[model samples]
Target: MDIATYTAFCLTAGPLTILMVIGLWKLFEKAGRPGWESLIPVYNVYIILKISGRPWWLLLLLLIPGINIIIGVGVAVDFIKSYGKFKISQNAAIILLPFICLPKWGFDKNTRYLGPSATISFHEKHRKDLQKSTTREWAEAVIFAVVAATLIRSLFIEAYTIPTPSMESSLLVGDFLFVSKINYGARLPITPVAFPFAHHTMPIIGGKAYWNGIKLPYFRLPGLGDIKKGDVVVFNFPMDADSPFYRPVDKRENYIKRCQGTPGDTLSLLNAKVYVNDEAAITPSHGEMEYMVRNDGSSFNRQLARDLHLSDIQQFTNQDFMMNMTAQSAALLKQQAGIKSVRPNIRFNGVYDPEVFPHNPKFRWNVDNLGPIIIPKKGWTVKLDSLTLPIYRRAIEVYEQNKLQVNDNHISINGKPADSYTFKLNYYWMMGDNRHNSEDSRFWGFVPEDHIVGKALFVWMSWDAETHKIRWSRVMRMIK
Candidate 1:
């Protein structure tokens, strides 16, 4: 079997089957139940549950998605306790290596099964053995830690650092954030077999960390909620859709941006201001805008800029200063003695930028004055015409896994003539708070729901590189 198929089989049936046979078989015999009962899957759980002193109704808790993991841990705790192995190390062993711990407890000649009424003193004999760590035990402990950490990081929360000024005042470059995977549901890794604790590339050595010999379909566990407008989201870069280095969705470079347009919402940009469904959207509280500041024929006060922590300021000319500043910062600069005028650097409408999304000359869309396009939601269909094709072609062909071809004025999908196409996945429009300096969905197009990583939760740590100091106030600040 291929690696993907083999791994799936192992997860669904393999180890658990052996675990039921070996561990539960001897366990059942000791508990005075029929050993043959362990051979049955659902019945085996019932037998174990009875032995563990847990009510059978708790099995329903094992059916819930994320809660099942907690229930399993609880079951392990109860199971080990029933064995009179009430030591902390015994519990940890049952959690980390149930296959080994269960069988060891079940079949060991020295180990005696004490019933539910057994006292805590029954575990005193095993405490010394747990303290004595062998080479094999050390190896197993390391492997267990890696596996547990990987599962938690993949399904729960992930630590991420802002490496760029794209998020600016909303999220700083040195802010270390804890991303909550459960917010938008955690995406299962398509390329599962990878180096532990490494993303796409290994640091310093710089080779790919994953083995792409096996690939899985995009799947996500049920989450607490879905992505919404005005929420800061972490998602994979979608423009890495081309060949040569076709990265899996999760392996693509992670980006953090505010969701300006949710699926099914009409989105547009008017003079650097975002509009969603024909209503002017609320900008982030500290979102920045580039301003053209005409000074009094001298260099702008670099000391004041430094004092305000405006690092990305530049002198465009002897009298003109171009700087990125928030509304408050701009107000502060406007009050300066030598400053002439501070106006927002708004790009004129109807100016075509080749780098913008759709990449067609006919669109004549720039970063500040683009779109008014409808975001794609699952099951929502759109007619494929000359005008609409360019807008959603990448989403359909690349993201939704459809073969698209355009010949003259005709459009065909999957070897059949089609005028309209329904999206298989939802798409969101993302933009940065540093509007002028950041490249976002306005440049590359919609972020498919599959590419979503998580929601930015909090900045646990922050480092100001220029100052070589820890940003005390930013640490532990919750992300908006």
Candidate 2:
């Protein structure tokens, strides 16, 4: 089985290892040595040295990097000689720790003096050969739990720290929480070219050359809903993926905006209040608001958020109306002292009527009040001319707009054209619940369905963003 699939087995080995160690320690105690000697780290080593009849200075061998190899080999040679009943060579046991007890039980005729034992091999040994069996079991259980936690954290859900204010207010610069991949599905394990811990199959763990050479056989999970307008989202920085030192952009590291538009939804920023299907958009909830229950506790909007430096991007917050502009209003604003010239994208220039104020909530580029654009979806096809720049077409070129030669013609999407078109996969739009601040579909376009790992289901704990302090109030909080 792959390394990931072997996790359970690796964990299982911990208990077995501890049990065997304790069993042998008991056998040593039966020979009149102190049983407590097995519990001390350095002293334990000394005991092992005594049992192997090696000099204490040899223990220093473990401190050296490559030097331990030779010393370890020697340790095995001597350790085999310590017990006549355990005839297996130390080198053999060291190489095959999983099966180490077999020799003690199968080959040895000596009866274990401590725990119960039915035979010479460890497989045949019983509780009689063990000293302080509870300690062994406890140690094994704890170690196994730690190992399992590490593996799961490394391979599955990983904690991310927001270090920038980019996604401010929503996911603060120092907010700490976990992003899960198992909710969607997991990638198959791939062996590393170098390190043992690099068992993850994601391209990031593979390194540049390693990742480039890896061809993944697709394993897909169902595509979830496109991040709605005004949803906070997190995703890999598209540009970083090509870099050698790529890292997932933290909430503070990237842009987090309301998902003004979703696939197939036509979006356009009218004076700037986000418009959807020609209607005013709503913020059903910005985020989960922390609250103290009546003498107890309670919570709402489990989503993360905080009002910060973002809410002031636009003027006229009093009214939620698209640019109610007109030539007269533009001239007035332009003529207004200290107010800058109206510099909107060329497409919408002068389109704002002085009589109207953009879309609603008085237009702004900030996440809260922006958009009315459509994101393209899969299985849905639009004729070439019907598509335009920065909309449905923008997403196609991201993952599916790849190039190919058809017979003699060359082609590319967005600009150039290729011979054939193959929609190998679909794309998704992911967003965080905190609408006002999130780096989501708006910036990165779409999350290719194939790259989707999993869903974020729960928040086990929460950490303050700016102070790097753990928020005790957020512990045991259920993620919406």
Candidate 3:
């Protein structure tokens, strides 16, 4: 584990567990149970649940994927109410900073445990009998809702809107998707304190949505499965790896792309076809490619174009049209009356794209003619040279957090002369399905494993922005 990850673990899990132990000890003593019971882990939760007027079987809820969050907060509310601490701010503190609130309530001189007594019954009756003010009730309700939603979004699934056509045809622009964090295990928030519902930027105000005061350590729960080749994944943009401002892993921009290469796999693009470990990659069934089309002096039908969801269409002449279309869509277009021919727009080999990954003048790699480059894996060492330096420089210096300097015919890491370096983390290569029109790993570089967000799950909703209509067919469509 890295220093930052260790620090975060101490700040959250260590302190929270200790505080809960102390608080539950005192609370348990007052409730006529053994104070030592609170020191136990799973048993402590069961004791607290029993004391909080809830069923003990509900502890099983913690084992479920998404439902655990609700159980956690519900238990917190019960724990707070067990002590007769009914104020809204106290409730908020209990949910947000239980490390502080639980200890404060437990050890404080005046805060008495009012549980398992006739007073406890009276307090419950009073609370249910409109004894609390209406405003307080609403405020507590809203706070609970926000806390539950935030936990759910952070740990299980989050709804994301597709803002670009980068993954067109496979995941179209305007598709509202539910990204499943548990598929690859949800990553713990590095920046734990942030504005609710707002991502990196606040709406309308146009500033950062998070504070840098307390950065938590990075960690991820055990995932349901590992990321495999050809999976549609969401990850943070690796370009932000060089930003001057501090952006936590989760707070960086969320980008959805297909994982073309995994760690230790050699990835290359030959004539626009991806080859992984010297084998042809299996493309998605609905994957799209740009095509140069010729029609016999007639415009394409508007209704047919709409049905095919063709957005990028340009007419070079009366008889020629350049369109970005899926193989399926292109085949349909060929059957249309007055159409002459449809040929995919393929970029030639050895054509240099200056904006490609590493941005080195020495490399003439273009989007369709990239690497036979090896993706770095954890603990894998490679001899460094002018040829390999540019390809892995950012991965070593930025993602791995090392000071790397290239000097006269030699490379130094942390001021030591080193001819080779071992990677600390696995790296992945990502690309958009819209082969001809994406700014992906081709434009950037390898995506560090830490930058991975989650797997794209389902299209819960999709909107046709240009036509201002709902795409009913895409609603609740499972993302393959």
Candidate 4:
């Protein structure tokens, strides 16, 4: 975590934690237990379980990350009920405003220690008041399910579907994926207030699903490891911050791509081949690119196209054609009857593509050929000048939330003239495996760490839309 995020967490959570401890101390004394017991960490939870009549085994679940949240809520509700408080609003107060409600109940003159609420004898004694109607029971069940599912989705794994061909043969369209948030560490909700099960927009309502008024600083729990090259990642689109859509960081559209360049690495593309730190990067085995195919003036069989999984086939003439397919498929097609030659459709170096990253004519970069520019790392400083400004401007000014100005070739950041600037957050370069057909980091620039969502783990299901059948071979396929 960065210094700013750590400081923000300390400011907000530190005080609430202290207040809850104090309230628990008073409530323990009322239950005929030592007040100082609340000062201990694990023992305090055991004490609460004992008072609430819950099993001591629940302490093991409390040690878990995602499941702990749900168990904690249940314990809080039962603890409040042991004090003769069973109203729906009262339970909500204890769960949501524990610091205030716990202290209020502890000092209240009417509040008295009742028997353990989770015990069978206690429920029988207060059966008349505690009995719930059929409708109320169903309502509570639905609420609990929603809360549990939301917590699991936020902190553990989430289901995502491949809606685009960006990842192509590696991860096909209609692939249902289980993206693991734990791989890169689960990011806490930046926009906490949102409609359940909805992403950025409400279903069939055509409006924002989240409120941006209560935004939180970016923070993540400890993860398995840092992001490595070649990992498939899903992140919020950085371009959503421009033009008509000024979305909150978390609310931006999600885009999945393979990590081509990590922090502190120099990345470039030479003739459609990715080179990282001057070494040829590992390419996906099933990755596809456009290939120019020449035939002996004979049309290809339909079965050949299906077998090759060829797409975007364009015929320039009777003997000349262009198609998107994997290298293995191209090699297979080359040996077919009446096939003449197959060559890669590559944009030559020094050919400028205005739509490419940096988007400047001076760079002369294209999808096939790009620069050896360095990816930004945390605390990595770069000179602020004409050539570098266009590359890092979006990351520095927009992503880092700094006010930048340029006057007569002089760079000023936050009202101070500067010749160089250091990055606060690491930035990555993401690109699609479908080199020619994908709109990825080649068009945009860098993906800030804050935009990262999770890593795509595996495909649970795969459906071929045109064939209207499930791809059985792709089911339960682990993504590389």
Q: What is the TM-score of each candidate against the true structure?
A: 0.81, 0.44, 0.88, 0.92
Give the per-residue lDDT digits (tens) of candidate 4, residues 91-208.
8899779988887887787887786753466668778977899999998898878888988888899999999888888999999999999888888899998999999899997899
Q: Over 4 Å off in model 1, which ranges? A: 1-44, 47-60, 70-134
Alpha-carbon shift of residue 31 in model 2 (angstroms): 41
Cα lDDT, model 4, residue 2: 49
Q: Is candidate 1 or candidate 3 better by TM-score?
A: 3
Clashing pairs in 4: none
Q: Per-residue lDDT for 1-480 in model 3, tens only?
A: 566667767777876788867877887887778999988888988888777767888988898766776788778876777677766677678877877877777788887666634346856578567476878779778876887788888888999999989888998889999999999998878787889998888899889898978766556888899899989999998776455745777788889999999999999998889999899999888878789999888767878888886768898899888878888998988898988999988878877778988688787788888888899999999999999999998888878778898778878998999899989788999999998878899998889888888999999999988789999999999987
Model with the higher TM-score, candidate 2 or 4 = 4
lDDT top scorer: 4
Candidate 1 colliding pairs, count: 0
- Top-TM-score candidate index: 4
TM-score of model 3 vs. true structure: 0.88
lDDT scores in order: 0.84, 0.43, 0.84, 0.90
Displacement of residue 132 (Cα, Å) in model 4 is: 2.5
Stretches off by above 4 angstroms in model 3 are 7-38, 50-59, 63-66, 117-120, 124-130, 244-246, 294-310, 315-321, 332-341
Model 1 per-residue lDDT tens digits across residues 1-480: 225556786686677658747977898888899989988877888877888777999888888776677678878778777777765578778875787887877887766666654544544655665564587678768866886788789989999999999888888889999999898788878888789999889888999999988777677989989888888999999876667668877788888999999989998998988888899999898888788888899766778987665656777678987888888888888899988898998999999999998899979899899978999999899998989998999888888777899888888898999999988788999999989889998789999988999999999999998889999999999998
lDDT of 2 by residue, 1-480 (tens): 224425755676667766656755664565457867766776776776676667889889766533454466556445444443333333345444624553354235574333222123443444465444677578667755654564465346656555654433334444565665444444333212323223223346444233333232334322334344554444445444334544322101222333445555665444434456787755333331111111111221112112222222332333221121223333444453333344322223233322221223233333333344444555665444322333333345544534322233333553665332333445444444433234455444555544443334434566665567787765554333
